[model samples]
Target: MSSSSTSPGRDSKARAADAKPPMREALVAAAFQLFLERGYEQTTVDDIVALAGVGRRSFFRYFPSKEDVVFPDHERCLADMTAFLAAGTGDEEPVGRVCDAARLVLGLYAENPAFSVQRYRLTKKVPGLRAYELSVVWRYERALAEYLRARFASRRDGNLRADVIAAAVVAAHNNALRSWLRSDGQGDATAAMDHALGLVQSAFGTAPPPPADERPEDVVVVVSRRGAPLWRVVQEIESTLTRD
Candidate 1:
């Protein structure tokens, strides 16, 4: 026995290895506190990792950069949104399905109102964070557009409709989110989001498909001399058609 296997250092290392999830969360919590206490530009990754009691490598292992820690749940929320869109049946309107997907995003923010509000304020102050937020927003919009395009592929204006609806849904979602965040997360977010989503639904959603047995009414077409009187043409056509 080398004795190292039974050493306290070895036991501590094993415990730390098993606690990766909590450690990652610690890093995130520490980063947010630091960003709040000392402005985002003032806080460094070293400060976060030190407060977290973790190494620089651990920070990188969880978040790619300082900005990522601010929106830590984005990856999980994006995946949830994608899953929601993927599970939709094609029978429903594309716009409605995409709107539902947008709800997943709002749900994520709603789950942590304080964190969301804080991040919102910080993002508005930081150009780099805002740009990163835009990239995330673009990814969400692209996912929605792809789903809509697939659903409407057979239609003539499918691509255009898909693109437009996706943009509209994103716009509506962001509007609701910003409103809630601006108010310090104090309003009925669901209601605000519902009102925003309703606009997109009314504008882009298609009515239910007609019954299978439904048929169009027969058209009465009359071809007569261009100068013929209207009463004469109508009477002559009706009499001729009804004769059979």
Candidate 2:
């Protein structure tokens, strides 16, 4: 008995298929490669799909548009940041907590330095990408502001304070993040971010004091002669209270 033989060409084709990258990753890699070869505007969804060896449907399945491919991980990172903020115990200092949330964003960039730097450079060159990036940043800022608003709900001008501090946190984080990206991801990004965030924490991180009613009552003690005159006793008590 004899068995049928597989052709060498077909065997090579099978191996190539096996070696292909995952669909989503392949799409992203293809999109960036095309973006670099032909400027962002010159590149189209058809080009990306063609390079990725995927159908247009597959490209849209992973990314809504060509711009989304450039910022592939942001949506996931944003979800993580929102979850992190929501998980807070309410015992954390609001400013410090929000600063920590900002770190999550830095962590995302740090995860893939080469890719992040490439994307950063691309964003700098593309006005549309820059606008899209700004919108994404705005979403992050809003998440932080919402968390802060809840934390500061009982404070005077709480909404204003939350919005301001949230903006500050985003500013500080982006400042550090962009610097790191500018450096080609060299040096300690965490240190840079911490220093920036430290400023925010120092400026607004103090845990708000408990409500006036919740504050501990002040205690006063007055010393006087055993047979002190009422007027003198009253004077001493008033002086003690005033001094305190």
Candidate 3:
């Protein structure tokens, strides 16, 4: 007998299992459900596992603990942003890759407003969760910094400038995201991100797209002390402009 025919019930059961909710989502739902029912402190991983209808191994498979269920998609977001930065950095004038990275991080928050809001609120209440969330934010920054350093490390900018650029981009992105989250997603995150990156690019004498067909000479160049960090370089230029 053919497999499906030999085990028709097994086929139906397999379809049902496939149709079952995603493990992470199910865990999130279970945790939040129990949190609503029994409070966050009262809800144990065992409770979540039982409530989620999976074994403790399955729960651990998706999240390290009950609290881990709160930011269910964080790992995936980090992976996605890292992948995007890797792909987009290959053709960079530096700022392009930086902006793409900034945009990628913001896009994660934009991907799910409700979850972002929920996670934000929860992070605010839980110190450990808040630290974990901050670490998560920094992970993206670290990845972007590595990419930026790789892109500019061989250029005249060298590692110091690349490090500063990466740090500036990450800082700019975090500030924009905090502003957006503070407004409860009412602000335009994309616009905030774009505007922030524009400032970063202007500081570096690089534009995101570099005005197609324009000669490289047309691009504004800010000459700095060759060894200065990009931030110090921008600061030096700004201070000079203000001095006169």
RMSD for all candidates, in order, please.
8.7, 11.5, 10.5
lDDT agreement with native, every candidate:
0.87, 0.88, 0.73
lDDT for position 169 in model 1? 94
Model 1's TM-score against the true structure? 0.78
Tell me the tens digit of each residue's lDDT in model 1 across 85-120: 877666776777888899999999999899899999
> Residue-wise lDDT of candidate 3 within 132-222, one digit each (tens)?
7778767777777787778776778667776787778878887888788888888788998888887888897464464668646433447
> What tens-digit string does per-residue lDDT give for candidate 2 at 1-244?
1123456645543343335448878888888898889889999999988988889987876678888999988877888899899887888888989999999999989999999999999999999999999999999999999999999999999999999999999999999999999999999999999999999888888966888999888888777788988999998788888993
Candidate 1 yields a Cα-based lDDT of: 0.87
Estimate the TM-score for candidate 3. Answer: 0.71
Each candidate structure's count of clashing pairs? 0, 0, 0
